[model samples]
Target: MPLQAHVVAPSRTAHVLEIIKGAILSGDLAAGSPLVETDLALQLGVSKTPVREALKTLEGTGLVVIRPYLGATVREMSYEDAAAVYDMRLLLEPEAVRRTVAAGGRLSAAERALERAREADGGVARSAANREFHRALYEGCGNPLLVASLDGLRDQTSLVSVAAWARRASWETEAAEHEEILGAAREGRADEAADLVRRHVAAFLDRLPKQDIDPAPPSP
Candidate 1:
């Protein structure tokens, strides 16, 4: 059965994108699931124009894959792809967080995001909160270019994290790690916070299934 996403008009494409992005993160639209325009349009009570535009945007986010003639499907990350994403994060995020911590950056937002993630029962909610928490950690690094680079990776990171959650149901462990990272940052232990961030990233990567995902379906 096709997934149904409800949306209202007026900048409907952005609304549609968020709705479908939430579905994908929450596993309502599982990896490799097809996104048929007609079905989505009918289900959403809109014309195919908005759906098409939203899909094209999602494709750029690395959450949706589009083939020449195969239409669109939720993206599937190979083991190498996952590793590379994590590796880039390992090289970038920890250092950024360290700079933020060293600069005595504000961290009230990170604390709030941590609480939200702990309270969230859905993967989508947790994913959004998690993104916010990490953003708070690094956005204060005083380097806009570095922050921008990290922002570029945020969507891919969310997809990878959701996949990791599917393999291991205990996000509490990750939450605990976040607590440690934040604690160090708040205490002005910049190096410790940076190292903790590194460990946290590596730990999540280790938790991923030790194999590449199946190839994406040509037509879902």
Candidate 2:
């Protein structure tokens, strides 16, 4: 009998997606920077097929822009986009958290995320932890579709967050706000928790830069 294969690598597209997305989020790739498929494929030791697929996925996530003749580049952040993204979050996230709290969902993951955010040394890690904290608060709302909608906005929201951090160093304020939100949730004050989340999101929106933040110049 032939030996069975138990170990297999994840799909190339998924791997490439993580690499490209990581770079984008960490500012390694920068906003508006070109995502040249050939260069990426060569750098990543893969073919253009995976790079192309990954770019398409990033585009869907609002992290990449593909123009008719420009190919793919990292998406830029602007006040308008920030308003739209956070406006939707302000509408959906608080209510979802309210539902989750009313249902008495587990919050261990949320607490862990909060801790991670507090300990993070930089904007990227903190943003990721912040995302996880919010997700944990709302992911147990018993509505998959609602969760999906929130999930759809995550990448764009995170991108805007990093940009906001770059403009203003106010993570301390946000971290304190998160603590209050988590405290309310932990105390089973559903309505209060919801209100805190709304305030948190709205405050972040208010801090967004009004001008567009373009990506770094494209490689020569």
RMSD of each candidate relative to the true structure = 3.0, 6.0
Deviation of model 2 at 145, angstroms: 0.6
lDDT of each: 0.87, 0.87
- Give a tens-digit lDDT track for model 2, residues 1-220: 1111122146778888888888899878877788888888877777888889989999999999999887999888777777889999998999999999999999999999999998999999999999999999999999999999999999998898888778677789999999999999999999999999999999876765575344435599
Task: State, as a TM-score between 0 and 1, how close model 1 is to the true structure.
Answer: 0.89
Give the winner by TM-score.
2
Candidate 2 wrong stretches, greater than 4 Å: 1-9, 212-220
How far is 131's C-alpha from truth in model 1 (Å)?
1.7
Model 2: how far residue 2 lies from native, Å: 41
Clashing pairs in 1: none
lDDT of 1 by residue, 49-140 (tens): 99899999889878899998989998877778888888999999999999999999999999999999999988778988999999999999
